[model samples]
Structures are given as C-alpha cells and as structure tokens.
Target: MASLQNAKNESHIPAELLIARVMQIHACICKLESLKPSKQVNSLFTHLVKLCTPPSSIDIKTLPQEVQEMRESLIVLCGRAEGLLELEFATFFAKTPQPLNNLNLFPYYGNYVKLANLEYRILDENGVVQPKKVAFVGSGPMPLTSIVMAKNHLKSTHFDNFDIDEAANDVARQIVSSDIEFEKRMKFVTCDIMQVKEKLGEYDCIFLAALVGMSKEDKVKIIKHIRKYMKDGGVLLVRSAKGARAFLYPVVEKHDLLDFELLSVFHPTNEVINSVVLVRKPLF
Candidate 1:
C-alpha cells in the first residue's frame, strides 16, 4: 500500500485494466442485499481487497472525468457494503447471550483487533498512554474499536461513543450490555458529532471513524468543529486512507487538519485498511 507521505513512483499497471477490475468488483458488491459468510461472497471480498492493496499507476486526481465519477460511485458502494456487513453481525450478536465471545463470527473482527492495537500504539507513542476519557465519533453498529480497546488495552478508560443512527447506538449498547465492566465503561450517544460541541472538551482523546465524512469537505468541517471544542493539548485520531485504499475511504490531507498540530500518520502496508492520522490540539 502507498503511504500518502511517501508514495512510490507510479507502477506499470494499465489504467484500463484497473478500471475493469474495479467495475467487476463493483457489480458483485451491488448484487448483494446484505453481506454474509459465503464462499462466493468471501472470494469476492478477497479479490476486492487484493485489487485495492496495490499502488496504482494512475493518480486518482488525474483520472479521466468518467473514471473519476466511477471511482466515487464505487467508493460509496463499498462503504454501504461495509455498513451492511457490520449491521448484519451486530444484529446477530445483539441477540446472543455472550456477544463478545461471538465476535469471531464477524468475518472482519480480527481486522478491528489489529486496528485497535495499532491505534493504541500510536496513542502511547504520542504521550496519551492512558487516556481517562475517550470519545469515538461515528462508532457504527459494531463499535469494535472501542470494545477491543476497552477489553484488551484501555481497561479503565471510559468511552463515550457517538453515532448518528439511533438504531446503531441501540445495537451497540446491546452488544456490550452483557459485560458488566463494559456496561460501566461504555456509553453510547445517539447524535451527530456536530451536535456534541460542549461536551467535546471532556475527552482526553477523540477518534474520528473512517466513514464519519464520506467527502473531503464534510470531513474538514467535522475536524474543524472538533478542533474548536476539543481541549487544548487533546489528542485527535482521524482514520484516513492512502493509495488504492483511498477508493474505499476518504483521504485526509495534512491541510484538512489546519489548526491541529500534526503528529504522525501511519499507512499500513498490510491488510489493515485504514490509515491512522494522529494530531494534537495546540495548547496555545
């Protein structure tokens, strides 16, 4: 995968071939009413992931107008596929007696485990070793990152999870309800991130989920809003993407985080799909 900061020179892959592959994957994804565990569905997703793992020769910005439109449409479709997958498993786990134990049932649960560990390491390196209170914006129906962090890493940290969908929040609450410790530590708020201005300052660290803002403009708006209300010196971790992964998630540029002091950005070369951008609110 290409790191946004240090992308390699363009590869020799033909743009037409790439577009064809993208279209094939797009068609398969579109046919799905909901994501489930099937050999065919698994194979399709595997191919999709492999297709996106390589650095593209064609710069997304320099793509032909029609190709760019296709790219945008594909990205939106992929995001919806991901959401449906999460909701499918979240609804399933919500009815189970022990949701945490059944997390493995979700095909991508291990990915979230890796992501949580990665983010935790970034926080530790940036002096946020033990954030007392953390806020996760756009925490979807699964809320796997918070659940993983609370269970494995930040045992004592209190998490305030915000989601625009009340149904998602309800499913998230039920998913964690059986765990006594999680029940005490995790609180889900059903509202958009933009509406939680006054309470933002209370968190030691804030996480912006990858799908929080599908467009660059909307992402910048949310980031700026967080910068305005976040406490001085607070840590902000925004999930971004690079290289071919940018086709699946929005890429956050350094300039998008205008007011915050840019700390570090890590783009994983492995199966970890989202890039992590860590920044801090300037004390001054």
Candidate 2:
C-alpha cells in the first residue's frame, strides 16, 4: 500500500519497491480471464502508469542483481497484459456488427491517435511525403496504428500489416472488413517479417511495433533482416521506450542500429508509452 501511495504521490520511487509493486500488479493482471473494465484493475494500471511517468531515473544495469533478475519477467508480464487488453478489444470488435465505428471505445485509442500524428509529422519532415506503399511489422490483433494512419494521416497510402499470429491477423481483418475504404487500403499478412524476403523492398516506409522483439538480441536480428531486404532510402520507424517505461518495454539503443542513418529520436515526457526512433536506409 505504501508503494502504491508513493506511486500516487509521484515521488522518487525506490527501484526495489517499484519492482515489488509491479509484481503484485502483475499477479492481479494474470488472474483475469478477460480484461473487462474493473475499477480495481483500472486503478492498478493508473498507478502503474503514474509510476512509469517522468521524473524517475532508472538505469537497468545499475540495479542490484536480485532486482535485475526480475526485470525480464516484469517485462514479459507487462507485455502479456498489453496483449490481453488488445485481444480482448479485438475479440469484442470482431464480434460487433460494425467494429470501426466503435474503435474510440478502446481505452488506449487516443494514444494511438497521438502516436500516429507524431509518426506522420516525423515522416513528413523526413521527406516521406505521400508514400504509396507502407509496411507495419508485428501489427497485433488490433492493428490500430495502421488503421489510424491510413484513415487519417496517409489517406492515399496502402498499409500492409505483417503479424506472426494467424489468429491475430484474422481478428485484425475482421475488425477492418466492414469499412470499404479500409478493405481497399489495409492488407493483413500472416507471416513473420523475416519470412518476407522480396516484397520487403516494395515498401517506401516501415513501422516496427514495440513488442515485436522482446529482447535486444531478437530486436537486432529483426532490424538487420529488415535492413537487408528493405529498399534503399526506406524509412524505418521503431517504437521504443525511455526512462521508467523501460521497466515495461525493451529499450533500443543507437548502437543497435548499425547500418541505418539515424534521423530522429523523440521520447515523450508524458503518458505516451512508446518513444519513436526514426531512421532511414542509406541510398548508397
């Protein structure tokens, strides 16, 4: 309760205390069969989000060995919670008569809207104007980013969404199937990004979702694979994390991006869960 109070107060939460609190919350999140809107769960998530916000400086390497041991598990737990929330909504929307119209009912729908706007602005600034074809790697069940971007920002661009899970792709397709415009613009492919060899070069821009690779090694491998197949001068937008958010998501460092020309890295000091890393494939 004290740790919860500390999170509410927005004080400098001790790393060990924060870790313990997260473990408790994770336990609660795991017990749920479906992520229905519960006041207790919502309050827990609210406190966790507050704790993860700005003003907390936590370096993963500097933590004690025991605490470090819990980091990966915590990340996995958080990712599972996120996936459950998405699947819950995706399943609901898939069953609905018109899912697209009810998209705003999603709790984190506003986050995707803001994120798409930010990514669109970044792409526009970096000379990716009116890209004809774009690809989104690891697009989950909801695929809200692709929908939001295609519907709002890049009205003319076609979005090819790649996800490893066939069920997720099915859910995504069902969610967007009712809209005629989305049916024309959004295409869901059920395959890993590594499997798409030749078609990768067709895209002018690619977005890598945050939960694509949960480990640094896996992330580097995916990045290298994309670099090998992606067209020259293609734009890559990676969703990353900074500050306390690293506790919930994997962090991508500059060194990990070896071949790409680093363009911009924007870390929001607000509630946005992901930081954006914009880079480009060199023409040479």
Clashing pairs in 1: none
Q: Per-residue lDDT for 150-242 in model 1, tens only?
A: 999998999999999999899999999989988999999999888888899999999999988887778899999999999999999999888
Clashes of each: 0, 0
The sequence of per-residue lDDT tens digits that candidate 2 reaches over residues 65-174 is 76665666667766766776888889999999999989999998999999999999999998899899999998889999999998888999999999999988999999
lDDT of each: 0.84, 0.84
lDDT for predicted candidate 2 compared with the true structure: 0.84
The predictions' CA RMSDs to the true structure, in order, are 4.7, 2.4
Which residue ranges in model 1 land beyond 4 Å of their true spot?
1-16, 27-43, 55-58
Clashing residue pairs found in predicted model 2: none
Question: Can you tell me which runs of candidate 2 are displaced by over 4 Å?
Answer: 2-6, 14-20, 23-43
Model 1: worst 10 consecutive residues (lDDT sum): 1-10
